[model samples]
Target: MSRPESGAPTTTPPPTPPGESPAAPLPAAGPGPGAVAVPPSPCLSKVELRVSCRALLDRDALSKSDPCVMLLMQSRGQWVEVERTEVIKRNLHPVFSKVFTIDYYFEEVQKLRFEVFDINSSSVPCGPREDDFLGAAECTLGQIVSHKKITKPLVLKHGKHAGKSTITIIAEELSGNNNYVELFFSARKLDDKDLFSKSDPFLEIHKLDDDDTFQLVHRSEVIKNNLNPVWAPFTISINSLCSCNYDRLIKDQPGVALWDRGASLGRDVPHADEDLASGPVDGCG
Candidate 1:
């Protein structure tokens, strides 16, 4: 991970109110008690999103979690399931290959939530509602579009569990193309700023914007007590990294008190001609 650039501060947009929903009218109530209500037809300008989960909590009694993700849209303060992924058996880290298409109204804030469930194979004959709750993550379409790609840690409280998970989201506009890049980084002989003679270091990657300001694009986890730290590899879209401009000013910073001190760092930029399996580029400070 790289350190965020020290450029003009970016303000986060206010989040949509908790109880508010889209202006579209809800479907009529079900005729019988305990009947499920149908979802309203989605409106214009749809966008497709890819979702994946990492480090999900296992909820099965005798085996690892058979996780499935549910995509929901907020309507009238209630969540309506718009799409769901197939159950991935016994995997804590699951990449849902299904792409979800939802209405994208630039004028309105579309609140979205992703719920993870541990599916019991036996319950498959019944319905998805019978799956065990695992965890959930929530965000708005505006927030996702603004960032291009967002990775957030999932919380289990929303699903009534006490556990953690992570969700990676990539948004592809209906009319735009998608490009991806993989990156790996490491630092060596970093100055120790802490009293214990070791530094807690991380990385933030920022992309220079049109206004000559840097916007944070990716952040790495903090590595403790190690001058030589190699962060986990991550994949991000080229557009989100620098709007697809190879010459754009890409800034990498170390997240530590001694960042000002000379620390040797390495950066590996992916090449278009090379396979995604290629190794990271090493840099020396």
Candidate 2:
């Protein structure tokens, strides 16, 4: 090739082939080497949970703990109990055969809690409060679904046996179905505590919260001068009702409370008693 003057322009590259086009340019480099790549979590439909305990603190004075597991889910800023396992008598290491089924929403951060209690007397039906406290564990559903299985130690921190024992957790995902519930309730022969021999009464339904306190979920209209009252029918999603668990307790308070007024029951008006009867109906109809 002959030498060109310094002012002369350089030669252009050759054109593309007849059928093929020019190669596209590569993209610019991303962030520096410090940038890390994260894998996306899998979306799951449902999950199954199996609970087991080891070296759990025995609440009973003279016998091994009859341990049972209770599962709770967080919803609406409150943790609601959903399921429970039957007590395994006198076994420090109890493998609950009862598998709990819960719907897993990948988009939502579903928080879960587990509590173990020691049953002193299996002959009688008692609430969690009556049962002896053993220990508890907490985690999110996504954590289990992502890993497919998780085992964690349970921590005990209460009473004279505080820091005395601990437990473990095991979880797995499974198929699930959409759950719903229809509820009906009625009261009979409610005591009339008013001075006029008749009282305005309404029903207040409460669901148990994580703090072992009852949170009001629903309320019925006030029925005037009626000893017997029937509430209107209603339907609710299982998640909203009790996180799809039926073993949880649903509390009902039936009485009249004058909030705006100065007088109130058990406060200014001395002690008084009232009896109300209520139960769930068989079906939505």
As a TM-score, model 2 comes out at 0.43
Q: How accurate is candidate 2 locally (lDDT)?
A: 0.58
- lDDT (tens digit, per residue) of candidate 1 on 1-285: 754457533344455578986343333433567777786664556566767778888777776777788899999999999889766566787665456777788778789998888777465667655347677889999898778678887876534533557888877565443678787877667656556456656665555556554454555555656667777888866656665666662343211221221222222111111111112324412
Best by lDDT: 1
The regions of model 1 sitting more than 4 angstroms off are 1-44, 128-131, 158-162, 176-285
For residues 107-187, write the lDDT of model 2, one tens digit per residue: 888999888887654423557554476777778988877764566666666433335455444444432436666776665
Reference-based lDDT, each prediction: 0.63, 0.58
How many angstroms is residue 218 displaced in model 1 relative to the true structure, after the best TM-score fit? 25
lDDT of 1 at 63: 66
Query: What is the clash tally of candidate 1?
Result: 7
True-vs-predicted CA distance for residue 146, candidate 1, Å: 1.3
